[model samples]
Target chain A: EDKVVQSPLSLVVHEGDTVTLNCSYEVTNFRSLLWYKQEKKAPTFLFMLTSSGIEKKSGRLSSILDKKELFSILNITATQTGDSAVYLCAVGKSNTGKLIFGQGTTLQVKP
Target chain B: DVKVTQSSRYLVKRTGEKVFLECVQDMDHENMFWYRQDPGLGLRLIYFSYDVKMKEKGDIPEGYSVSREKKERFSLILESASTNQTSMYLCASSPTVSEQYFGPGTRLTVT
Candidate 1:
């Protein structure tokens, strides 16, 4: 069975702090791993990592995947209260386009 | 930009009642997915449609049905609503098999 696990189910950080969220997966025929941020209602796309040891970044957010290790990490620098939300990780299959999602990491950035 | 929309932001249904949740995407995406979100469980896929009229069962498809009669619209049906079915339902669409865009979720409550 394919499974995705996220560590540090919940975290508390102050503004301007840097936090790293981890996600590990065990899936057959893994094609890509994706990260999302959910604030209130919807989850917005963060990044999709398909290559090992390569980093994808946008502003204060960055992510990297280790395909060889079957894990991924999302880093947020200079965290703010607006960054408080649940971060999700999902793994996709190349053949079926199916995705298996992790339990998510809830981040609370205090002002 | 891709936009995904759901029929309702909140819904209340009684046990044994039939419920329908609708999703529409404006990007003419080839893949549409339905998932339920719960505390501690993250997102569990209920069903997915790769093309018009082509539907596939996802990880958690029991007590649910799906319809994709058109390219931009997908619907999820709860045959008989139960307390266990109360959850936040999310809709997502993808161009191929990656980088999914999500919609504002519908919170369903069965009492």
Candidate 2:
């Protein structure tokens, strides 16, 4: 069965702290891995990683995938209280394009 | 910009009542998905549509049914609403299986 697992189900950090969220997946014919941030309502797309070793960055957020290890990590630097949200990881399969999501990692940035 | 819209931000339905949740995408994406988000469970796929008049069961489709009469609209039906079914329902659209744009979720409460 295809599954996605995220580590440190919840985390608390002070402002300006750097936190790393981990995601590992086991899927047949993996195509891509995606990261999303949910603040209160819907999740917003963060990054989509298809190749290993290549990092995708946006502002203070960056993510990378390691296909050989079947895992990915998202790094957030200079966190602010506004950055408190749940980070989700989803793995897409080649056959169905359907995504299997991991239980999100909730980050609470204290001021 | 891609916009996915849900019918309501919050809804209240009585137990055993029929419930409907509507989603519409403006980007003309080929795939639309319905997922239920819970506190611990990140996002569980309920149903998805690949094209007009085409639908498929997702991971958690036992208590949900979906309709995609047109390319831009997808509706989720809960035949009989139950207290346990109360959750945050999210709708998403994607051009392919890569990056998905999500709508502001609908929070449903069954009482």
For each of the candidates, what fraction of the native contacts does it recover? 0.82, 0.88
For model 2 chain A, give the 10-residue run with minimal summed lDDT. A91-100
All candidates' chain B TM-scores are 0.98, 0.98
**Cα lDDT of model 2 by residue, B25-62, tens digit:** 99989999999999888899999999999999998999
Off by over 4 Å in 2: none
Residue B2 error for model 2, in Å?
0.7
lDDT of each: 0.95, 0.94
List pairs with backbone clashes in candidate 1: none
Clashing pairs in 2: none
Q: Tell me the deviation in Å of residue A87 in model 2.
A: 0.3
Q: Candidate 1 on A1-111: residue-level lDDT in tens?
A: 999999889999999999999999999989999999999978998999999999999999999999888999999999999999999999999876678999999999999
